[model samples]
Target: MVLVDAAFIIELLLKYSFPVLRDENDRIFNKPLMLQDVWSHLQLLENQLSFFILEDLFVPEKIPVSSYGEDAEKLSIISLSLELFTSLMHIEGIEENLKTITSTFC
Candidate 1:
């Protein structure tokens, strides 16, 4: 299955749910979107999400890199935990953020 991002999901919701605009010739006009159409359309949104989570929430400054040093095994465990937390938070934000994005796009 395709791994759809929030903005992609929003655009699909828009194109599927909203009415298409007509041209001067009274012909149904709609832009064709390819597989990456969603990504293209939602690049800004995706970037915003990435910035919020990576830069804002999981700030590198907050992660004590120096504290986990010396012991390779302990450092690995700490690094793994941080990665897991980041992934979990990202997944959790997907649904709520997608809903917000859908409403905004619509």
Candidate 2:
């Protein structure tokens, strides 16, 4: 969860500097938009995260890594992300949030 939050913060930095990609008349292009508009979208994301996550609980337990050939850091990240996703699914009102997300995004 901490890593996810850090990545989001990093993405917001490019929200102003990066060009917005658009699809129009079956053609796609990058266009610059107002910084205020980008700020509002980023603010909305912050609000949604707060609304969805009711509690933040962290249990720090070390995972043992094999001494042989596998990559330790990559395996650790994948394991952590899966654990976080499973817990997030059980949060209150998560069903409604998932429904809203499917309609809004997909």
Tell me how far the alpha carbon of residue 84 in candidate 2 is from the true structure, in angstroms, after superposition: 29
lDDT (C-alpha) at residue 39 in model 1: 40
Q: Report RMSD (Å) for each prediction in the order shown.
A: 19.0, 17.0
List model 2 lDDT by residue over 1-106, tens digit each: 7557544533333221222312342111233344344345545644445422222322212323322244332223223433334443344545456557546754
> Can you tell me which runs of candidate 2 are displaced by over 4 Å?
20-106
User: How well does each candidate superpose onto the true structure, as a TM-score?
Assistant: 0.18, 0.21
Clashing pairs for model 1 are none
TM-score, prediction 1: 0.18
1-106: candidate 1 lDDT, tens digit per residue: 1223433333333333223412344222244434244344444543434423322223333333424445222222223333333443354444455457546755
Q: Tell me the deviation in Å of residue 26 in model 1.
A: 13
